[model samples]
Target: MIDAEITFRKLEIFLCYMQEETISRAANQLGISSVSVHRALHSLEEGMRCPLFTHKGRNLVPLPQAHRLAEHATEVLSKMHQGIDETRQIAGIGQGRVRIGTLYSLTLDTVPKLLMGLKLRRSELEVDLTMGSNSDLLHQLEHQKLHAILISVTDSDVDQHQYEVLPLFEDDIFLAAPKLSTLSDRHSVDLRSLKNEHFVSLNEGFATYHGFQEAFKIAGFAPKIVTRVNDIFSMVNLVQAGVGYTLLPGRLIHAYRDSIRILSLSSDYQMRQTIALVYAHNQQLDPNLLALVAEGRMYARRRSEKR
Candidate 1:
């Protein structure tokens, strides 16, 4: 039976002693005291039930048996280190699946590029994605249904305790109107300018709607909201129909440029929303999660620099 106390360190010292052929030299190479190296060599020899080395005056020379064991020891240590590296890679902290939730606005460009970059760097990893409203996605994140979530920040209810948030980018809100509307010819228009016109808006829980309300208040008029829709696509569709005008992210205008005309906001009260990626505070230490957060921060910085 093998003695449990015969450790890998002993084997390493044994191999070092064989290579250096001197306890003092081997200890120097290993950054260990000579006494400790000598103890390890003797312990390994005892465990193997054989004398592994012969003393040549002050120098130690390896026996035939010791040379054979040293060869095998090198292979064994190499395999052991390889196993450790592969295991770490499989733990998702190095190379494993990351489930992410994002808002629809981000799905336009930045999120896809980030995912593509992650995939290129770690080909073995799998990414699962979900898109929804900030509130819905945050709820899923709280329930541990997702590894991380990217969402637009809002004035609505938020739970500060459960998540670790990193603010990424801010998108200005633009006024999207029908292609032939009078508002389309203007370079910029305040919310008050659209007070008499019909307005399309997102439903109650959306961050865009809240931003619109704030913009309206700043313009000194409560908007005459004629329609409330669920998603940006529907809101944009309503604006395209000549039914009304709506506030949307600048990114969204670029995405659906063919469908509607985007106009800049005139007042100093420009509406904007901050986007961020959030994860559980406890999971921050997870190697895979930490790597993803680092990648996200890098991606955000790069995109911000381009702006």
Candidate 2:
């Protein structure tokens, strides 16, 4: 009985010979010697128990058996390439699971919407979502604990070489305060103008806090910080309780619009935070990662259109 598990190389050689009509020419195209090509053709014929070609002077003519085998060979090669491509995509070598880290601010808004779109398109894909401070998330991404991270970019700890940072969105920092607070005179407030007021902000190691500090510096004032919270939700809660006004990303205001009022900053003290999708330079491409990136792009486009 002929072995069903025939090598693809043998089939490739046979196809090359069938196309070129001469062993020397086929060998030249395949970058192999004519003798090697002849041996491969003989081995393939012997395994199939059928003649594949007939020599006609300088050219080789395809026999009836050769014609049938050629058709099957073409199909086999096409399917093999397709199977390999699909496997690579699923294995994170071409496409696979995308482990992602993000901040709590984005989780309630852009990230969920993007994930929903991705799930609709690729039902079999897996996503591992981790939430943390920007510094912690960036560390996880660098150490390969996560495939990529969505974070707020700050100026102090910028490391461009280690990551492929793609800016997804930008939003101004808003002052969230109680409706009856003394500082809530209008819909907008300046950081320098409220320098004497108590402030609530994210805990240490958060990029937003660092950025807020820089904004204070640029405004030529230091805030009287009253309390520090860990996440945007906590900050909003504190602000709502009249504990203190807190600086938060505009996206958070949109997500938790009912909890607090968003006050735009004055021109001299305006601060914009940039949201970025960051991945390691050497990270492997996977189907899940590709799907996430595609979803992120879609989300960005939709947000832009709405603006």
The number of the candidate with the highest lDDT is: 1
C-alpha root-mean-square deviation, each candidate: 7.2, 8.6
The local distance difference test score of each candidate is 0.80, 0.79
TM-score per model over all chains: 0.67, 0.69
| Candidate 1 runs further than 4 Å off | 1-95, 154-161, 184-186
For model 2, how does the per-residue alpha-carbon lDDT over 54-110 read when each residue is reduced to its tens digit? 778856688999989989999999999999888755534544466789998888787
Write candidate 1's Cα lDDT for 61-84 as tens digits: 788998898888899999998997
